[model samples]
Target: MEIKLTDQLDQIYQDARTIRHHVFVEEQGIAETDEFDGTDSDAIHFVGYVNGEPVVTARTTVTKKGVHIQRVATEKAARHQAYAKQLLEYLLDQPMFEDAPMFYLGAQKTAIGFYQTLGFEKYGEPFEEVGIPHVNMRRTHSAADHHDR
Candidate 1:
């Protein structure tokens, strides 16, 4: 699989849209407006392709506190293959986030274990966001956490 960073929407527009549609629209019934916030212009989008087919997508928004990961999804065929994990590792390795003191993401309740494996810890009580239960998670950066497989 290969991953690319693009500021231009043209490069990842289709894949990112499809992934989000599957996760937020079809599967989760999250409103279109909530899923497609007009923040793409300022976010760094990452798309991962396997065998030349886009299989995973995610984006990062730089905030005053840290980098916030959002829209993380994998094509159904790509699930259980570690594509999300790989995409996340690639994101963290980017120079833009390498020195950031914290990394944060709003994780679906069902997927919190996956994030914990990467060293993220839930911060507050779960709350409904767009009809799904989510909790804020944060991880302080450390050489060890980044180096782990």
Candidate 2:
């Protein structure tokens, strides 16, 4: 697996969008309008490829609170292969996030456990997002703490 990160809405970013489209729009029935969200132009994207085909994608936006993780998806056939996990672990160690206080995401109910294994903790009441049940989760960042994961 190869993971690429970019700020430009170039080919790598487009590949990320394709995976999101498949997972969120086609498979999950999310409205394209909601899934695209006008934020991609500004967010940093991560795309993971296997055998040269993009199969996993995620994007992050640095906000006042910290890094805001969003649009994480892996092609159905690629699920449970650790691509998303590895991409996120790579993302956290990037130079851009070195000074961030924490990382957070609105995790779908089904994925809460997956994020927990990455050191995230639930902190808010469950809520609906894009018509799916979700809960807010955050992981405090400590250079020493992250390495042990």
Candidate 3:
């Protein structure tokens, strides 16, 4: 698996869009207008490829509160390949976010277990986003704690 990160949408825009289209628009029935919120231009996008085929996509943006993770998806055919996990493992290796106290993501209810395996702790009551049940999850470990584990 290969994980690539870029701020330039032209780099992985098509692959990312394709996966998102399949996962969000087609499978989940989220409106394209709601799924594509026009923020890709400024976010740090990640695309995961398996044997040269892009199969997973995610993006992160820094906000005043914390780093917000969004649009994490793996192609339905590639779900068991762990491409999304690979993308996140790559994030851990980056030096920029080293001492952060927390990391946050709004996890789809069906994927809560998946994110928990990566150290995110689900909190609050379940809420709906994009017409799907979701809950906020926080990786409560300090950066050092996460890396050490």
Candidate 4:
């Protein structure tokens, strides 16, 4: 698998769109308006490809405190194979996020356990976002943190 970073929409836009389409539009019935926020223009995106096929995609926006991970998704056929996990790992490894004090993501209720396995801890109470229950989660990084895994 190879992970690439690009700001040009042409680079990975379609792949990211496809993942979101599969997960939100086709699978969850979310309207297109809710999926494509204006944030993409400023956010950093990561695309993971397996054998030249785009299998996973994620985006992150850096703030003063940390990087916020969002829009993480993998093609249905790529589920259970750790493609999303690998994409996240690659995003966290980027130099821009290397020294971030913490990494945060708004995780879907059903997917909380997966992020927990990655060291993210749920914060406060769960709330609804776009009609889906979600909770804020964050992972603080320390020198001793085993991020390699």
Per-residue CA lDDT of model 1 for 1-149, tens digit only, reads 89987777875766788888887788888888899988888888899998888889998888888889989988776899999999987887788787777889999999999998778889978898887889999887773366474
Q: Weakest 10 consecutive residues, lDDT, candidate 4?
A: 140-149
TM-score of 3: 0.91
Cα lDDT computed for each candidate against the true fold: 0.85, 0.92, 0.82, 0.84
Per-candidate RMSD, Å: 1.7, 1.5, 1.7, 1.7
Could you tell me the lDDT of residue 29 within candidate 2? Answer: 98
Per lDDT, the best of the predicted structures is 2
Show model 1 residue runs off by greater than 4 Å. 143-149
lDDT of 3 by residue, 127-147 (tens): 998778899998745633754
Clashing pairs in 1: none
- Provide the clashing-pair count of each candidate structure: 0, 0, 0, 0
At residue 96, give the lDDT of candidate 3.
67
Each candidate structure's TM-score, on Cα atoms with residue i matched to residue i, is: 0.92, 0.95, 0.91, 0.92
lDDT of 4 by residue, 77-146 (tens): 9899999888887776677777889999899999999898777889988999889999999988862176
Check candidate 3 and list the clashing pairs.
none
Global local distance difference test of model 3: 0.82
Model 2 residue 95 lDDT score: 83
